[model samples]
Target chain A: MKVIVIGGDGYCGWATALHLSNQGYDVGILDNLSRRYWDSKLGVDTLTPIAPIQKRIKRWQELTGKTIDLFVGDITDYSFLSQTLRQFEPEAIVHFGEQRSAPYSMIDREHAVFTQVNNVVGTLNILYAMKEDFPEAHLVKLGTMGEYGTPNIDIEEGYITIEHNGRKDTLPYPKQPGSFYHLSKVHDSHNIHFACKIWGLRATDLNQGVVYGVLTEETGMDEMLINRLDYDGVFGTALNRFCIQAAIGHPLTVYGKGGQTRGFLDIRDTVRCIDIAIKNPAEEGKFRVFNQFTELFSIKDLAEMVQKAGQAIGLKVEIDNLDNPRVELDEHYFNAKNTKLLDLGLQPHYLSDSLLDSLLNFAEKYKGRVDKEQILPTVSWHRK
Target chain B: MKVIVIGGDGYCGWATALHLSNQGYDVGILDNLSRRYWDSKLGVDTLTPIAPIQKRIKRWQELTGKTIDLFVGDITDYSFLSQTLRQFEPEAIVHFGEQRSAPYSMIDREHAVFTQVNNVVGTLNILYAMKEDFPEAHLVKLGTMGEYGTPNIDIEEGYITIEHNGRKDTLPYPKQPGSFYHLSKVHDSHNIHFACKIWGLRATDLNQGVVYGVLTEETGMDEMLINRLDYDGVFGTALNRFCIQAAIGHPLTVYGKGGQTRGFLDIRDTVRCIDIAIKNPAEEGKFRVFNQFTELFSIKDLAEMVQKAGQAIGLKVEIDNLDNPRVELDEHYFNAKNTKLLDLGLQPHYLSDSLLDSLLNFAEKYKGRVDKEQILPTVSWHRK
Candidate 1:
């Protein structure tokens, strides 16, 4: 089987590409390297030192004797995307190429507009390219759990059977996304569903949860092939940020009541879930969805867990409460169904089991590179 | 009261702008004149001969002795839109500015990309401008009923309370839009909802049905003030196209079995609905929605009604069933809730009552202007 990771230079994409290549599938990496560009633009860097894309790929090839093809261009450019797809002609395409930070989107009007237009138009171009040339290829698009917000009802995978006024029909789940970046994902899901229905295209939308930890099996094989670990306020997840704070003497900044709950998974499981989705493709003319997460945690719970782990390793960690920068429910009912991926032969990874080895140790080693100014939230959801 | 009608040169916008101006409100029209440009690009003309927007505004002032300010600029340009809004200082902004044709959107990849980007970006710029400069202004955005692709269950207004798994919550209605154009409207709805939630902004999304007539009370005041009527396959509605075909002695083209049912109203009612929404603005931090149609009809029923009306007016009419160019259900249950506007004192004009005076007679008078070459569908939903 042939697969292309469209954001193969980024964290999850790099790990997934390396894992798939190690699994003996012909792999190709297609990225514009915008993830690095954004880091430079924002004056931030990944907590872990990582090599360039070419160097990472070269080191992997030397160690594993596998050649991963590379295509460097923007997906929003139709001619470039279509030409790249035609040149590679893969059976499956994993799309993680999007402006992914919610804070970056909410910074101002210009950033918000750029985030939406870039994400929505990029996905639209890929859909059109698939309909025109690669109708048979399967699209494994990465969506986010943020698209669901904090609805009162139990969130289904991608759809729900709504019994409205005594009539029942399964419909796309109602989305109340909280940010412009998440709203873009909701738009992409709708667009992809329409394309599948009309043009007989196949797609599997992986509505993934917050990904934590840094090392995947392939990335851990060599330091030169290490994955990027973001610890800044803009791009970092709660668990990762907390672990980093514990490693140094910085306080774990908990926004508001810290009762906001969400689903989460390790980076290793993200790669595995992508593999499982690609192995079991949706039928032609079908749009499938899976909630890709193994466990759930509230911000308060993760803070306490990180505190205990740091104390066990002889580190003093304090938790501080601050006003929430985001306009979201501090406490809400959030029981989302994530059994679809589990049913499809995905052995999960738990954050509690690997906290010290996967996160804390790495953060302690990279304490010199941690920029303390990036630890506090800088972007507020409310307009000034 | 101060009002700014965006895209006020287009069909619905022109009618609504004149109606508001005549009702003792200070009205300003901000348009890019892209509607006329698109007609030239497609090599199609409106069935009704209309004067230029400047001439139309001038004639309205002459007849009513009321001035409507004109501001020519694209809403997609943030700086241009923000400057115009600042200059106008509108208390209410009526947004009817969008690429409104489904077939035009599906012409090809370029068209699809253009439609979504134009509509979404333009609407985003408005929301941001509202947040930055005019937080107190009310936004009366023109959305389409087509945003809710015919579902099996009865469609609620913009939200439905679903009883699922012993839980209940009123959420935004699930959307299954059929085309890129409709999807763009759905995207705007989501974006607007988010803006209202986070910024304490007020917005009312009018999910309007197909608007069928060429003249409103204000537009019929003089020959120069006449509203444009589209009769080409790319821009024409079914009832308008049927009336035009009857006038020219051409066959009424009904796609497939013509069982595709939809909601519809008169062009007069469209202007009236905008007035009603503006009078009763949504509260700050609230996103209100109203189903803005009065009646429903299947395609076959509309064609048959045109046939009967044409015979009574001494014209021979024939109905022709053509293969559907767009991929949609020919027969589907389409019971939608539209009582919100009625409860708000909207006196609707029925198609049966106005078929002769409102549509057929006008089409007959303009029969010489019909372009036969533009009658049949030029775009297909399926990619070749």
Candidate 2:
């Protein structure tokens, strides 16, 4: 079956491309290398300096005898997106194209506008293309845990069946995201849901959390297949930042009292979840949603976990409680039920000591490239 | 007190401008005349062909001796919006600036894209400008009743407190709008809510219903002060369309079983709601919402009312149930609470027999201008 990944250069996108192609599906990748440009702008490169998209696809073909087509373009260009959909007629389309950083969105007015436009317009274009050309294709979109924020109750996958005032109905979970980027995702989800209702198109929205680790089967053969290891404040994930902090002797920065907790999964597991979603598409007119994370951890718990993990590798990692740059609850109740992905046979890899060691080893090789200035929070939610 | 009204040329916008200005406030209108162009494109001038913005402002100045400045530009233009915000530095901003037609949104791909971009980007520009220039400005934006399609239970103003699995939190209701234009409103509301949380910029999103009638104080002057009233499908409200159908001896086009009930108020009451919302500004960091309508009526009931009222005014009317163009629950439950505005001292003018008679009488004067082609459903939600 033909498969096209819209944002096939990011952390999870690259891995999915390689794995799907290796599994004998016709796979193609489309991206603008926006995250790379963002990293370059911030003077932060991924840890191993992986080869570009062409080289990555070429190396994957050489190693696994599987060819993955690659194209560099903005999917927000609706005509281009429509042409791609019409040409490929893929059985499934994986959408990961969006501005995915909260702090980057909070940086300035330009970044904020860019985030809103890129995230929303990109999703709209993809949906428009699907409706125009490949209406039968299952669209598996990557949503986020941030859309739910820190509500006092347990978060259901993407919906909650409520029985209020003696009437029962299943409704999508009410969202209250924390940042512009997250808010845009909320918008995309709602728009897609509306499309599904109106057009009877098939779609899968995986509300995944903070993804960590970067090992795909293709990574084992060639370094090009290894996922991006962005370790800067703007481009990096929580775990990636913590690892770099430990390596560079910078404090493992914890915001406020550090009781803010969230669900997370390995990058590999994200690919696995997408694979499962593609294999089992939702019914036409039905919006299937899965809470795609395995476990949850607070910031303090994660920082201390990294600190201990670093100590095991002969690196003393100090901790610091910085004034919280973001305006969020330091301590709150958060219990989201991510049972859907698990039920879909996601054998999740928890954030173990071994995984931390592997991450550190990757960072240690590029210790010289770790710019300490990029480790601090450059964007604040509160305007001072 | 100073107030800047975005989309100030709209029905509610103009009415609010006149109402607020009469209440002794410095009011300036910022509009791009997108609605006027939409009216032109649909080949239906507002049933009452009112004067243009400049002429209306001139007339308001001449008659009431009240000077309300006019800034003619799209709110989507961030620079223009920000400059206007800075110049006015108004304590409150009435943001009625959005593409509000459901049938127009469903017309085609081009219309959908236009509605999404115009509505969302316009709201985003307004929000960012508020954050950058005037954080203290209370933004009163126009949301819609369609945002809460046909839910099973009672709908609160802007939020509902849900007790889920032993935990309770108030959330903006799980919006499931049925149209691209309404979907845009849902997305923009999320943006406004997020902006309020991050920037502490107060905003009131008035989730109003279809506004009918044209009898505000300033509109009493002449054609210049007379508010625009569209009676065509593209820009017309259901009641306006029914009224026009009565005037032209055409069928009142009701979709499907015509059991789709919704809250509705008068143009005068819409103006009243905005003035009340401005008087009771939302606190910083609060997303104040009010369901600004008085009574509810199904589509069939509205058509019957118009037919009966028009018969009293010596006009024949027919009620025709055509194929439903939109994908919505035709016969479903709709009970929305609108006590917030009433509590804010809005004595709602419910849809009465005399008011319906008055509406029919008003339409008879413009009986020659009613175009029969503009009265039917010109858009469909079918993807095929």
Candidate 3:
């Protein structure tokens, strides 16, 4: 089956693209390379050295004897997106094209607006393109668990059955996103659901959790094919940041009380989740949702795990509690059901000390590139 | 109190601006005049001959000695919106600026993108502007009842308490919006709710129903100040279309089984509800929602009413059930709670034969201007 990965130059997108190519799917990538441009704008570079899309695709072709086609343009541009869709005509489209950073989105009004327009408009364009050209294409959209925003109840996979006043009906799980970035995902989910309802367009919204680890099997193939590792205050996940902090002898910064628990998964697991979703497409006119995470941990839990991992490596690691920059519950119940993907034969990879050590080793290799100033939160969610 | 009426040249926006201005609030209108542009693009016009913004505002000023400031620019443009907000420094911003037509939204892929981008981006710009410049401003956003697409079970006012697995929590009511236009409203509600939560911004999402009626006390002041009455396939509501059909001696065109029930209110009630939302503002960081409609009616009920009203005026009106161009439940149970607005002291103008006669009389006055060819459903929700 033919598949197109939008935003294929970004970290997860690139990893997923390579993985799908390795799986012998006819893979193609369409990206505007905006993430790289954003890194340039923020004066931050990925800790991991990553090749250009052209070189990365060429390397993958040489390494695996698989040619992944590349189309570079903004998905927000309908003409370009439709043209790309017409040319590729994939049976499935994996959408990872979005401004995917809460901190980056909350940096300022400009950043906030840019995040909304880029993410929401880009997703809407994809829906429109599918309706107009490839109505049969299944959209595997990467939503975030952040879209659920640490609700008190156990998070259902994609929807919840509500018995209101003796009448029972199931509906999309109520969203309470924490930031402009996550809010955009919620918006995308709504639009995609509506489009599916009206147009019979098949879509699966993957409510993915925080992804950690640097080396996917495809990325570990070569030095040049490595995925970008963002260890900045903006784009980096807490676990990844904690591991890097330990490697660089910086105190692991925990926001507030560090009781903000969240679902998490390895980068490899994200790839596998996407693969499972693609392989098991949503039925026609169905907007399926799967909670894509292998484990749940709080900031303190992650910090302690990193510290333990550091101790094993003969390194001293300390933890510091900082005032929370984002407005969220410091402590909350976060038990999300992830049985759908598991039921679909997903072998979970829980975070382990061995995994932490590998990530620390990778961070140690790039210790010189770790900018300490970018490690602490700079943008405050509260306006002064 | 200074109030900025975004999209103030449109139907509900114009009347609300005038009503607020009449009530002695300093009112300003910020519109891109996109609705006018859309009418031109669609080769249709409002059944009622409406004057341009300049003339309308001038007429209001001339008659009532109240000046409403006008800012002619797109709200999607952040700079323009911020500039308007800074100048106005509004205590309340009434947001009615959106592509409000479902049929127009479903016309084509381009139309769908335009509607989503115009509505969602415009609302996002307003949120960011408020966060940046007027954090204390009470945003009175005109959400639609269509956001709660005819669902089984009782639709609570903006939220529902779900008792799941022996635990109960109140969440924003599960939305099943029917159209791209309504879906954009759902997206706005999510984004606005997030903005209020994180930024301590105060907002009230008025989930207004389909507004009918051509004349408000403010709009009835002068011909130039008259609100635009859309009676076309794309922009007109079913009741208004039926009234026009009666006025022009045409069939009361119903779609399919015509059992699609929906909440509705008079244009006068819409203006009054906006006033109530502004007067009793949502608290800081609270995203309060009110289902703003006076009554509920099905398509067949509206058609029958129009037929009876036509009979009262000695005009023989025929009823015809055309194939449903939209993919929606032709028959569904719809029970929605709307007591919040009533509790806020919104004395609703319930649909009565007298009210129907008034609207029919107004339609008869512009019967010559009514484009009979534009009355039927032109845009099919089903993709061909």
Which prediction has the highest DockQ against the true structure? 1
Query: Candidate 2 on A1-384: residue-level lDDT in tens?
Result: 999998888888888877777778899998988988988787777766778888888877777778777777888887787877777778899999888899999888778778977888888788778788778889999899999999988899898888778887888899989988898888889889988888888999988899888776667566656677877777777887898889888888888999999998888788888888988899998888888889999989999999999998999899999999898999999999987777878798888999999888878877887777777788888855
lDDT of 3 by residue, B54-159 (tens): 9999999899888999999999888888987898789999999999999998887778777887887888888888877899999999998888887678998888
Order of quality (DockQ): 1, 2, 3
My TM-score estimates for the predictions, one after another, are 0.99, 0.98, 0.98
Residue B122, candidate 2: how far off, in angstroms?
Answer: 2.1
Error of 1 at B287 (Å): 0.6
The residue-by-residue lDDT of candidate 3 on A1-384, one tens digit each, is 999999899989999999999998999999999899889988888898888999999999899899999999999888999998999989999999998999999998778778887887899889888988899999999999998987778889889988778788888898889988898899889989988988899999999999999899999999989999988888888998888889999999899999999989999999999999999999999999999999989999889999999999998999999999989899888888889999999998888878998999999999899888888888888876
Order the numbered candidates by TM-score, best leading. 1, 2, 3
In terms of lDDT, the poorest run of 10 residues in model 2 chain A is: A216-225
Error of 2 at B166 (Å): 1.5
Which segments of candidate 1 are over 4 A away from where they belong? none
**Model 1: fraction of the reference interface contacts it also forms:** 0.84
Q: Go through the candidates in order and give each one's DockQ.
A: 0.86, 0.75, 0.71
lDDT of candidate 1 vs native?
0.92
lDDT (10s digit) by residue, model 1, range A109-179: 88888899899999999999898889999999999999889999999999999876777889999999999
- Candidates' interface RMSDs, in order? 0.8, 1.2, 1.3
In model 1, pairs of residues that clash are none
Q: What number of clashing residue pairs does each candidate have, in the order they appear?
A: 0, 0, 0
Tell how far residue B302 is off in model 3, in angstroms.
0.8
Residue B32's lDDT in candidate 1 = 98
Model 2 TM-score is 0.98
